[model samples]
Target: MVIPKMAQMVRCRIGYFTLKCSNRVVPRVFLPLKYQRLCFHTSWLLNVRGKEVLMPSLSPTMEAGTIVKWLKKEGEKIEPGDAIADIQTDKAVITMEYDDEGILAKIIIQEGAKDIKVGQLIALTVEPDEDWKSVELPSSTSIPSAASVSVSSESTESATPPPGQQNLAMPALSPTMTSGTIVKWLKKEGDEIEPGDAIADIQTDKAVMTFEIDDEGVLAKIISSEGSQVEVGQLIAIIVEKGMDWKNIVLPTTTAPVKSSAPAPSVSKPAATAAPAGLKPPSSGQVYGLAVKRLLEEYGLSSGQIKGTGRVNRLLKSDVLSYIQTNNVQKVKLEAVSPKTTKADAASRISAAAGKPSSYEDIPVSNIRAVIAKRLGESKSTIPHSYSTIDVKLDKLIDIRKKLKVENIKVSVNDFITKAVAHALLECPDINTLYQNGQIIRIPRVDISIAVATPTGLITPIVFDTVSKSLPEISETIKELAYKAKEGKLKPQEFQGGTFTISNLGMFGIKEFSAIINPPQTAILAVGSGREELDSSISPITRMTVTLSYDRRAISEDMAADFLAVLRAMLEEPTFLAVKRARNFMNQVE
Candidate 1:
């Protein structure tokens, strides 16, 4: 390892360094001399310290990203694992966590800074409260202006430049979306925008949809031209200090458009398949762009009549077509609303009818709604699902929860029910199998996912080794995953790989409802609100009802009913579940 004495001229470039294992050495002639000729070694060593924060390898395809905002401001103290910035990657705006504790001393690449290659330094961070001058900064390639990072100590510091002045890149809206076409600008440069304000219309391979601001900011600059095909993470616009210089902001040419040969139908003509009865149809004028409109036309469906169900009502042409095939119903002609209005006219009319178009009204799909749509869509199309619901008097389970609550256990009614189901799974092992890879994959362990509803979406985190975990452990896991899911921080693995799922909305006072089975899992249990009412004896009391939606493919009606019967019995006798714990809970009891 060699250290450069000259700090100002030292060029720090990734890949220049090679790591040689001192434990073993090969002959000089046999070794690659060129690889050994460069800088320091080690695969994970970050060479440059006080400089820009380069793009991380989030996925295989991502090469670079524009800094959307620095979550931590210059001079602000940050600990390792603290998110320092939010980067607009090709996929989404992901939080960039720093691994070292420091104060953000300088910003080599300012917020909205664009077109940075991977491993390029974007900021300078030094040990907290350390002298900035003592820090070693490699000063090769492009040196950012020192003035760019200076901030008045009294000024309210922000991670990014003032809203409207910070540049944001287009996001990869979907797993398959490689690029986006800017359909139109909803807000012009200099327009004031609040969180949720429509900034622009972007057309992805799937749909034409509007993107909104996550935080309140102003529209400062338009980077790529309207209609340009922008790759995910490519700067599309800039919002920063009102008069910040953008001359040094370098953006790579938008990547080549991802082309597809699929033919889109004409906007004027609806596609052959139509929306279901009572659903409104999308008109040619309402079609935002060519790709989405063509796909909609081919399917002959209306956007309004069909629920978008995406994060935003960003419907791709595929969604419309998929809705048509799944519902298997023809479109119903919508009643004309007076003289029809053109798309542009409707925008103006809505703007006039409502107060500010900037404050436009749109109902975004909560994370729950999006997940529900995806799961239900898959279940309906892919899984042959038939539901079986049995009403179990929850008097015993409620009493058990009450006793547990008094003991400071605080187990929810859902918790008690989940334990009962786990016990049942142990007895009826076949009911716990999942259909995958065109065969029934019997999971050896019982992993149950509890559906928790948060404002953002419905997420089900797993109760690991459900058969083995105690009631309290399962309840604790449920609470933790539920919180993470509501916060949108749940990793894919957390919600994945379940043999069965339980969806309970009893707390919300919902009663006796059927839930769509979450795919790959053979069954889902929808637990509804318990009610206090008179029973067959005409005595008033509180009780709950439950429903089970099962995959008819792997489980027969008789087997499903038997599983519920076991669950009902276990719930009725709390000791039945206690005995389940005695069995080591490693495998299903049955």
Candidate 2:
């Protein structure tokens, strides 16, 4: 006998029966002569029904994703490598591919559905011959337990009711924060929270920062415990609407806390572990690991003397180096104890005899300041710098600027200087090269970095292809970039990598100053304020002193001098700035 088709039937067992009493077939006893078991696996039953396509974890730290767009529509044929949708994770928007070849039966979550948890049903796929209407979708409750469905750790932790539930996830504080450690919770469970309230202090890879809540609600539950390292976008707490009864709200079962990509030491544990035989751990307060400890020992440094920037005030290699650098500490070789001293000791003795400060306040460095310190320090120490100064008569340029102002075409002296410098770089290509890896890299394009001072620190936003942009265009671009720089909205590409740098202190009434070369660029020009002076003929002229600080490795003194001479000539002529069009200016410069 044939059995009726049942979709739920997973397995079937066949047995043989023999009857002995019945005369019709002479079957007396029922016995199992042979047995056959039919096993139906989900992978083998692919052609029979549609499979639910769950949201995939595109990134290691991605807990939920926003559907940016759908590439394929319902009933569309999909191949294994076809892109089905674009998912926006915490870090970036990435394309999602269809791993199984089938027809796109349905899209459960439409485009722009944000914060959709991983392993949640996103779409459905059915075999080409299978009827899409007849396919049954697994219930939301049973979706996680489906044979083909596998829940991610993030999904398991965030499987809460759709409405009236909000997840407070660990945010990506910076571009590099893969995970963050909970420093401390400001508000406990059942506390009413307002927008912009500091919920917790999180220690990221860079620094410890306060995590603020953007929504006004009651923090109903804290999912991740204090001191736990949680991945970016991982659920850290639960927040309910302000009027809702938080205690009555059913919380999802909390999963194990997500581990950070970076190994964070537990605060309660001992900072230093037992060293190998014949090696002793440093007597510092807390040294992070063997590498740091080894470096400290090698440098004959004490961890306590260096500020700890890692989690739980642990010493990091970078912190050690920064401390050593800031303190001007040097590694001294100890020989047999004799009263004989070296040059360094003599220098130290002279410095001690000169003066000794009783005390001073130690200020913690900001992120931008620290970066500036490190880069400037490195540039000053490594690069052999040479300076060239020229006092150019800027009376013509000043008159041109005044005439432009009358025409409502506002252009600053710096804009004219930038244009002239771009032209000068075209004429003197040797000054446009970069010295990197002991090789002179010829940069074909003239991308000039204009220094903008922000509240945090100094940043240089690049004016790309400066040789091709007109003065007014450069002026507008500089204004926009300066605004963005002050607001800290400048992207990495906007502020990084340039063939040359220009820093103008003219607005602050500064006369002449040398600027440190922003490597790997060959040179930087420092512009001072234009001061009125009388020539030998008693004619009034505005004179501005410009200093060129160049990397001696990439550019010779003569090459730098020629570039500045051309720049001064162009500025002094000032008619070159009249040609507002780049092509006309190029022709004029040539």
Candidate 3:
């Protein structure tokens, strides 16, 4: 889409006078003659031969990536297709590789840098004996088109800058930073600002940090409030009055409406705010203080005409009814109202019966919470679910976990249990099948979903290709994916396409409970706390009680029992599962 470069006119209705709009732009020089040559400097370098790197797309759908790390030190010669750095896209961590021949002489951009837009210059490398740093760099203005400039003067006849250059917005520190609250302005309307001078203390989602000026020019106007939610990419301020030595900064003409010296009387729109005749207008208090006020406004009724029978002379529906009854405007029966209106009236009556005023709480639902709600609601309503519980000895699994911890695996006992269930899913595919369209869809791939508790609610992000992956790989992937899920940043693919799910409450110290199956998929494995107990021989024993919830339509009782039995055995003897994983990996590579 071609965005328009329209000039903005700032006008306000002062008292009783209506101001006329005018076409004007801020007067400021765009670029110096020295900076103008930056375009020609880089024009020749574009055709220069360089190494082309085809990095692995982190997300299955990512087309490009931003280099997060450069593991290979620059100026170090490397072989073909060597893993240099880690590139992170919208979804996952991918390996960055390049054709190995030239020495990495210069790193144009460093780590933790974004804006690696497709085909953008990320780094510079030199051919053997070639000087890469000798290449001329382009000025920031050389890369952009022209833009309109806003000139604020006491008189209206100030020269306006030519239109077309769009302003590049300020960079945000993080995604959650909605608005940066500007603390203080360091420069005035006509002072030059360098590339790295503290312009303002921008309070972000985390801590307040100093926002630096990009180029040297006079500081124009601050556009944002000290404390307000600013959009991700927005011009917070402007720089004007350029000099020969410094490049000019063109300001965008279209800025948000500021609190002008004049305040326009906001007359409510006729379509939305027109009230009935002979009724006194709404109070000049708040626009919407109560539900009665809004309801009256919605139905075109005024506040004063309706006799308030509610507490503290507040208006209510009964008062509106009484007022209509007292005046013989029109006679109507309740049943004459449409069904939709009747239902609304019924809901209102029920609400009134319950309490005096409407009370509600605002809850912020994360991406994880939204997914959990959608999945569980679908599961409870659609799946024909049945549950079965079995006690398994945790002695072997616990021992395996301890041994792995010593080997630097750093996985919890719960993670091991999840792996065991994944193994069982591969052995008994019938238990992993889903009932859909009058047939059992037995999935060949095992993508085990583990329930994670986020700030909002429970969510399950799946471990991709779990059956084919080893224990350590599964554990690491699960840890990374779970952390992402908890942070409410897991992509759609991570939360979807799961064959079976596991919800472990072991850390919560709960003994055992049946978990509801997540829908379409037939089964869910619920894990509880493992504890020490004396067996039939009065010996100390560590055991765990596991509950499997399966769709009766999809899985038979015998099948569920057999599936749990296999799962129990795997957990009881983790060595078998480890050996099986090794074999599977070897087979895949072969």
Candidate 4:
């Protein structure tokens, strides 16, 4: 497929694969002729000549990217985790890091090279022993054309850069983001913005992301106002080169509509081939996945029915919902589940349920809240979530907590649950894994991410090395993390990266509820409140419900059940925690 407006020449080896749709070419490492499913990867395959620095996917939505600048020139020695170049992704200009020690043999794509497809041969790296100067570019044997590939729209075209003016179109801040709400404009009209200067905080489907200016310019015009939901690539602001007249400049018109502007009466065309009701396809290219194709078939939506808002017209899951709302299309499952409804109808239902006014208030979704929604939806959709629940007698645990309270060593029930989970994971290591790039990584340390509810949304702050910390230490750490999460004072390391996650709604009196598994991690434990009940002895016994949601690909049913059983044993018998801690301490002493 010919990728339009992409001046960069993408060269790939014979065994490599390249998937192109709507001017978006995504390079793959599959054997020739392999098709059906697509998954994103960061590294390129290696050949006898050397490794190709295939353009790394900087963001989840990025199928293609631009090489903003190469930090290491050709022939420069690169260590593992070296930032080689800055890549312009759909989200931001992220520095691309190399993971292996090598000599930068040849640079295929240079700085300012735009629309370079992800996984395409951007550069070739040679081992330190090899001659970097003699290394040549990878073979330009273009990936053989796919026989049955979905094509990008023929009517789609790129907007040429007008003179020296920069059209600051709304970017896809997250993989699922089609349109973003301008939360606040950091750089106003007549303000000068340098490259990487924060321009505005954009409320994407995933989060409120700060959009940074990629080029130096004066804010000539701000088209989309604050709180306006602008679709990806829709002009929100205009930037002209440093000394341009910001006050008198006229705004340029584009095909993309300002979505959050005044709601006008929209009409769907009778012609099946006509464009989507009021949406514009975004970016320069697109990537269609298997799930999206299946959804299209399920919804009976043609390409023309819904405009994509992903990397260069890449269709997103949210786009399907947008189409359903736009056309008032009746869904197959919802017919039996509920009546067909529009936004107004849904709002009225909510109001009636809450005993509120007929007109409900529209709460602007913050970036953080969007993150939770997108993650929950994507986790439920992409991952085959399997569940295993265990009901553990909490009499022993409750007695221990009460006894500790008398000694001034008070610990919450969640602390005990968290500690018990750590012990259980250490025993059944198989369940403590992460599914990434189609690989199951069994993490050694037990870093548990505790889901904490804050004003913005539920944020998980990780408690690293939970297995090594004492119960008091664990309680202290959790309290600190929860406080930090609520205050928005969590550092990157404090919140990011974990092997397991625990979400407790026990405090809210929720008896039982399954939580969506966090990505990368294999499983999450949802803890419910403990309740007193008779357990065959005509005596009151406290029992707590805990459910484990796991990725079927990484964890089996047996694995999940065994993990829960171990967890139940540890929680039901409080001595197990002390014994496990002692054993660990003894091992360390040895």
What is the C-alpha local distance difference test score of each model? 0.61, 0.70, 0.58, 0.69
- Using TM-score, rank the candidates from best to worst: 4, 2, 1, 3
lDDT of each residue in 479-590, candidate 4, tens digit only: 9988877766665446656889999999999999999998878899999999989989799888889999999999899888888888888888776564433443322221
After TM-score superposition, the amount by which residue 535's alpha carbon in candidate 4 deviates from its true location, in angstroms, is 5.5
* Candidate 1 structure quality by residue, lDDT tens digits, 55-126: 676533345665767787767888879998877654356788988787787776766544455677777776
Candidate 2 stretches with Cα past 4 Å from truth are 1-364, 581-590
> Please, what's the RMSD in Å of model 3?
18.2
Model 3 spans with C-alpha error above 4 angstroms: 1-371, 436-439, 580-590
What is the lDDT ranking, best to worst? 2, 4, 1, 3
Inter-residue clash pairs, candidate 3: 25-149, 26-149, 26-150, 26-151, 146-164, 146-165, 147-164, 147-165, 179-230
For lDDT, the strongest prediction is: 2
lDDT of 2: 0.70
Number of backbone clashes in candidate 2? 6
Over 4 Å off in model 1, which ranges?
1-250, 255-360, 364-371, 533-542, 576-590
Better candidate number, 2 or 3, judged by lDDT: 2
Lowest lDDT sum, 10 consecutive residues, model 4, at 146-155
lDDT of 3 by residue, 1-590 (tens): 11135232211112122222255443323344453333222122232233433335444334445455686776676667877787666444456777666666556554534434445555555565544444334333121110111111111112343332224244444322333445556665556677777777554433345666545666655555565434334455655545432234444443442222221224322333334433447563322223345345434457655555433444444454455434432322234333346565666677789985534445754333454566678878888788899999978666666655555666677767777887888889997776666778787878888888766577678887787777778788888887886665665446645789998998999999989887667899899999999999999989999999999898889999999999888887777655533443332221
